[model samples]
Target: MATLQIDADNFQPTITNNATVIVDFWAPWCAPCRGFAPTFEAAAEKNPGIVFAKVNTEEQQEIATAFNIRSIPTLMIFRDQIVIYSEAGALVPAAFDQLIEQAMALDMDQVRLEIAGQQASS
Candidate 1:
């Protein structure tokens, strides 16, 4: 699967609708981000069920701000619209794979219930 480009406009709904979302916060000028791109892309290909989104901080300032992204190559994992994991820095392929496994291993039922609760209250 190719990495999906996400901007401020589509980001919210995309993450909200997906059962699992992995967002790569990156900038084109950052060397680490550029280097990590292939690894990220590989991960996306390995996991077809998950939604992998790439947010270019330079072009999508609002999306970057919403996530409080202070560094390039940050990875944020969202389950049912709530952030479950957020880390700053570029990850090697092995570490990135582990992170994805961790995200997948999480209790998704709890996440779904939490989202439901939030929706019920709103």
Candidate 2:
């Protein structure tokens, strides 16, 4: 599967509907963003079950602002409608793949429980 170009219009719905989503926040002018594109694409192709989406920060400023993206090439992973991972910077292919594997291996039930516990404490 190829990466989907996501905009403000579809971003929420896409994240809400997909079981696993990997979002790349980038801009065309960023050198590192351009460099990381291929690795993101290759991962998308390799993991068809995961929804790989890209948000052009230059064009979708609203979406970028909503996420408080302060850097280009910010990567976020959403699983079960929760943000499981978010980071700013380009990762090597091995690290990226390892992240995907770790995300997939997460016990969502435990994650939710932890979230609920935190919320309750708050």
Candidate 3:
């Protein structure tokens, strides 16, 4: 599976439809973002079931701002339309793989319940 180039137009729909979506917020000029591209692409090929998408922050400033992305190579994982993981920095292949595994292993029902509980308390 090739990494999908995502923009503001498709971002919402993609996340809404995909069960597991990993987004890499990057800019072409950022060295870290460039360095992380191959790793992200490889992971996309390895995990055919997951949607690996890239958002170019330089072009899609609105999306980057919406997510509060302060740096390049920000990684975000969305599972069942909920953001399960988000961090700024490039990850090694091993760590990235581990994260995917953990995201896949999560019990979404429990996650939703926790969200509901938190919302209720709030």
The candidate 3 region of ten consecutive residues with least summed lDDT is: 1-10
Candidate 1 wrong stretches, greater than 4 Å: 110-122
* lDDT tens digits, residue span 24-120, model 2: 9999999999999999999999999999999999999999999999998999999999999999999999999999999999999999999999999
11 Cα displacement, candidate 3 (Å): 0.5
1 versus 2: better lDDT goes to: 2
- Relative to the true structure, candidate 3 reaches a TM of 0.98
> Over the stretch 1-122, how does candidate 1's per-residue lDDT look in tens digits?
89899987889889878988999999989999999999999999999999999999999998899778898889999976778899999899999999899888889788778878999999
Worst 10 residues of 2 by lDDT: 8-17
For all the candidates, what are their Cα RMSDs to the real structure? 3.2, 0.5, 0.5
Candidate 1: lDDT over CA atoms?
0.90
Colliding residue pairs in candidate 3: none
Off by over 4 Å in 2: none
